[model samples]
Target: MRILALDAATEGCSAALIGPDLALSRFEVAPRRHADLLLPMAEELLAEAGWSLHDLDALAFGRGPGAFTGLRIAAGLIQGLALGADLSVVGISDLAALAAGARRSAGVNRCLVVNDARMQEVYWAAYDFDDRDEPRCLGEEQVAPPAAVVAPAGEWYPAGNGWMAYPEALATVHAAANGPVAAIHPHALDIARLAASRVARGDAGSAADAIPVYVRDQVARKSA
Candidate 1:
């Protein structure tokens, strides 16, 4: 299966292509240039694989609980690409993608992902990796002040810059198990891999179903 994935939901922007035996990717920390960098990056990755958009079986992207503009940028790109290629679309959660990064980097089975929500709050979620290598959401995604969000019961490492933003609150949560937070952001490679699994299970949606999962629209709108 040939799959293409893109993520522009934070300071990091990335595009990746996953073919039968080849995985090619490009990532950049261009906070204000996701709109500019994403497509060109996609073009480059496709060219590297000697494939075109129409050759892809599916398109995937990081859907929010992230920066408003960044989320829209990713969704818009996926929509256009999916429509043009007449492919199925999957919206991977940005927080889940972060958890996937942590799982890959730390070899952990459980993770707590928190992305800075930019209003003295965070977008948070708990994930447990099932045997099938898919992340299962343990709690509903939410936007909350760090102080009010309690850690899930069990051994789970924290990830994302949200903990860095509110060290005191995160420190309390981590004190239970004291696992180190991963220093990596979500990558398009993980997004593509996860989306491939989902697409295989008949879990894709139509292009019109492409939507951002903003935890707090009010905060997102204010930021926009």
Candidate 2:
């Protein structure tokens, strides 16, 4: 099945398509530029693949716990595309996508992701790759101060910028890692892969379900 996915939940923004010919992707670390870049990236991928939004079997986006604006941008775009095309959509977790990248790039089984959430807070989650190579979140995703982040005991690989964003606060958390990889962000490619799985399993949602997931809901709640 053809799947198109986009991510703008961090400084990094990416768009990816996985289907027929070959996988195509565009990514850049352009903070505050997601609004400008993400759409063009998606259009380019679809154009290069000679497909339109309607040709896609499913649409996917990083439903997030990262930049509030970035999350909204992606969700709004996904909703428009899905609704216009009358297609189903999937909301993949940025934290889960980060963990999937860790497994794909480094073969790490366990992952702990803590992305900067601003205001001295972070979006954190733990995951383990099962034998099927699918990432399963160890617990619910959360947003909290770095020192308040709790991870299950294991040599989980440290992923995301929170490790660098609040080094002193996260030192103990970092010390429990199997090894440190450079700070990383979620990618649309991984999001597509995860979305494909969900779509195949009949778990894809309607266009109206394309909504941003702000783990720390008070701010979003107030705005809503």
Candidate 3:
């Protein structure tokens, strides 16, 4: 399966290409520079792999519960790329991607992905890895103030920038440490890998379906 994925969620920008024998990617925490860096990163990965958009089976992006601008950047790019390439597209949750990344980097079975959604709130989700080692979301993703956040009971490690953002408010969860490893973020490689399964199952959508999931939509309006 040949899949190309991009993510400009949070403070990171990245692009990745996954083929049967090849995996190429680039990532950087370049705040507000995603628009400038994302395309070039994608182009570089394609060039390194000697592939074009048409050569890919699908295009994927981190469809968010992230910064609105960052989410739109990735989704809009995938929409354009998918349409031009005539390829199916998949939207992977940025929160879920962070959980998958937590599993990958920390070898944790149960992970709590929490990202700072600003305004003293966080976007969060709980995940438990399946037997196949794929992240299985336990409940709906939500946006809440750090003081109101609640995690499932277990030896779970906190992940994403949220922990660092409100170390005091989230201290209970942080104190319940499953080992000091509470920092993770979305990555294009993880997005691509997650999309690979969806693509295989024919669960992907058309180019027009590429869209961001702003979990904080209602919350933002109410707060405002």
Candidate 4:
């Protein structure tokens, strides 16, 4: 099946198209510019592949625990696209995308994904490459202070911005770790790949069901 994935859940904006025999993508690290970059990037990728929205089997996006505005932008765009094209949609976790990105780019089998969740907390989850070479979630994805994150089982490679943002709190995790990935963002390519796996397992859902995974409930402090 062919899938088009979009990710603007963090500082980066990316779009990818993956199929049985083709893969194409466009990515950029653009803060506050995801609204402008996402659709055009998807269009360009589709044009390059000589395929249109109607040709894709599903649309996937980084349903996030990253920037709230970025997550909304991606989800809104994907909702419109899926509705217009009458396509199925899959919401891939931003954390999972980071894990998948690490495995694809760094060849890491075990991944510890931690994204800065603002308000002095982080969104984190653990993953291990399965027999099928897919990142399998090893534990519950949660939002907590960096120090509250427990180290996952086995030697793990860390990825995402939280480690860089809260080094002291995450210091202990680094000890039993393999190392850090140079650059780790939830790329659309990995979102597409994970969505494909979901599709293969008959897990794709309606466009209206494509909701963002904002792990935190109270996103902001109560007004004084």
Candidate 5:
């Protein structure tokens, strides 16, 4: 199966292509240039893979609990690509993607995913990987002040910028737990892998169903 995935739910923007034997990707940390970089990055990945948008069987993207603008940028691109290609779409949670990234990088089974939500808050979620290497959300996704966010009891590796943003919360959680933190970003590669699993399970949805999952919409405002 050929799948294309993109993520712009934070300071970083990335696009990736997953083919039968190989995966190609493009990533950049362009905080204010997501709109400008995402498509071009997608184009580059597709070009490198020698495939067009229509060649993809499905489209996947970071749905959110992230930057409002970044979430919209990714959602809009996924909608356009899926609609134009007549392909199924899957919206992967940004927090889940972060957890998957940590799992992929650190080879850990459990993770605490958090992204800086601005406004002195964060987008947080806890996940544990199943035997098939898919992240299962352990709790509800939320946007809240770091102090109020509680980690699931037990041993788990912490990940994402939220830990860095709220070191105290991370410390409090890890001090009582068994494992340490593993800092990582949600990469497009992880999104593609998760999307592939969704597609295989017949979980892809229509383009109209491709919606951003913004936990805190009001936090995303145009600055004067």
Candidate 6:
């Protein structure tokens, strides 16, 4: 089964294709350019695999609790591509993607995924693989001050920009945790991998049903 996935949920813009034998991807940390860069990156990756949107069995995207604009951009693109291609789509969590990334890169079994959400808060979640070996969220993903973030007891490898943005605060909260792999950002490669698992279980939804998850409802703060 071939799957195409894209993510623009943070400073990064990334696209990936998982073909029968090989995986191809494009990833870059280009903040203001996700809107301009995502589609071209998707096209290039598809072209490299000698495929098109029609050839994909499913399309997937990050459904997020990160930048509101970035989440919308990715969801909009995924919706269009899936609609045009008449393909099913899956929405993978950016938090879950971060967890998967930590497992792949550092063999971390427990992960605390946090992305700086501006306004002195973060989008954070904790994850550990289940007996089925799929990453399972420990609790609801949330947006809160680093100090208010609750983690499951035991060790966790910290991942994402939040760790870098407020290291002292996060460290105070998760001192028992081993890392600050702050360089990691949600990537479509991991999104694709997670989506592939969902697809195998017949869990993909229709293109028209795709929706972005912005945990923070209001895009702008009211004057205080």
lDDT, model 1, position 122: 87
Task: Compute the lDDT of residue 146 as modeled in candidate 2.
Answer: 96
For candidate 6, what is the lDDT? 0.88
lDDT of 1 by residue, 64-120 (tens): 778889989999989988888888999999888988888888887888888888878
Point out the worst 10-residue segment of candidate 2 by lDDT. Answer: 215-224
Which sections of candidate 2 miss by over 4 Å?
220-224
Could you tell me the lDDT of residue 42 within candidate 6?
Answer: 90
Per-candidate Cα lDDT values, in order, are 0.86, 0.90, 0.88, 0.90, 0.85, 0.88
RMSD of 1: 2.0
lDDT per residue for candidate 3 within 5-104, as digits (tens), equals 9998899888999999898889999999999999999999999999888889999999998999998999999999888879999999988888888887
Q: What is the C-alpha RMSD of each candidate to the true structure, in Å?
A: 2.0, 2.5, 1.6, 1.3, 2.3, 1.3
Greater TM-score among 1 and 4 belongs to: 4
lDDT of 2: 0.90
lDDT of 6 by residue, 34-133 (tens): 9999999998988888897888899999999788889889999999888888999999999999888888888888988889999989999999998766
Checking candidate 2 for backbone clashes, the offending pairs are none
Lowest lDDT 10-residue stretch of candidate 5 = 174-183
How big is the RMSD of model 2?
A: 2.5
lDDT of residue 169 for candidate 3: 91
lDDT of 4 by residue, 18-84 (tens): 9978989999988899999999999999999989999999999999888999999999999999999
After superposition, candidate 4 runs with Cα above 4 Å error? none
TM-score for each model: 0.94, 0.94, 0.95, 0.96, 0.93, 0.96
Better of 5 and 6 by lDDT: 6
lDDT accuracy of residue 198 in candidate 3: 88
- TM-score of model 3 (CA atoms): 0.95
The segments of candidate 1 whose C-alpha lies over 4 angstroms from its true place after superposition are 220-224
Runs in model 5 deviating more than 4 A are 177-180, 217-224
Of candidate 6, the 10-residue stretch with the lowest lDDT total is: 174-183
